[model samples]
Target: MKEAIMIDLDGFYLEPVLVSIGAYGITPIYEKPEPPESEEADEAPELPEPILIGYRVAVPVPSGLFKPRYDLTTWKAALSAYDDAMDAYCAALAAYDPDSEDEPSQPPLQVDLRAFWIEGLTRQEIDNIRNAPSPKTDQQEIARLEQQSTISMLAITELFEMMLPIIMPEE
Candidate 1:
């Protein structure tokens, strides 16, 4: 007896399977047929049954169905912006002076900074800056910049996560 199986091709396995389908634009589903029940089945020398292996259905998969949700251009830009922000923050840190009474200039941050802060300055570095007897204004400015740098880093991380499906599909 042959059974009809309906496969759902729209779930997590879609992209990787679709990619394997290639230019022919169709995916094939195959099933092994059940063997006939016979009293001599155990006594007869088993011959490989060709009929049990050949049944399959060609499933049409539209190329457009696999389009990526995230834009590659935007992902690259986010990474670049994060790199720039980190560079600026590092430059500002190297130039910092504990004795200077003047307000430390704010480092230029990329306009695209919008995300949760992940990691950046070490705890020791933050403690040294915040615990110092520097003016409240200077402490606040440095803290704000640090926050921006961390947030930018997190934004890039998020973009990469969003692009992972396209970059490395699960097998």
Candidate 2:
């Protein structure tokens, strides 16, 4: 069976994001092998039908646990799969209702979405807001973020150029 999938920017950047069994990949086993008939005919049990639900993602983890592999099973990471998802879910909630000062109606993300979802954002959200109806508060917020992002990027680029040597490559 085929399913529609979305590729959103979660800062994976060409790296695999470790996903839980149900949360990520799941190869389907259509049928199980038949059981043995007589006392000795060896045969495997019948299997259940399943579908590869999602992508097999890997989470880039800090080095240390069990010989420094690039992935982690713990939830310690700020951008851990579950945490990242929760953050997005929270953002959706916030965007839906930014007025509630009551502690976010959800837990504060270990890290802010504003930082991670920007480029994935920067340009898209601007028009999205303008096209939205009413006072369009969310749209306005997106516009402000867009400007702040541009300024921030320019300042950073300038700082880097001034602080470091600029070398032009020979043709």
For residues 46-130, write the lDDT of model 1, one tens digit per residue.
5445432221222332333222122224435776787888888888878989699866766655533122112234568667766
Model 1 lDDT at residue 27: 27
For model 2, the superposed segments whose C-alpha errors exceed 4 Å read 1-136, 166-171
The pairs that clash in candidate 1 are: none
Cα lDDT tens digits, model 2, 66-122, are 222212123235456666778787777767655666544455545432222213333
What's the distance in Å from true for residue 7, model 2?
57
Q: Where is model 1 more than 4 Å wrong at Cα?
A: 1-68, 103-171
Could you say which candidate leads in TM-score? 1
Using Cα atoms with residue i matched to residue i, what is each candidate's TM-score against the true structure?
A: 0.24, 0.18
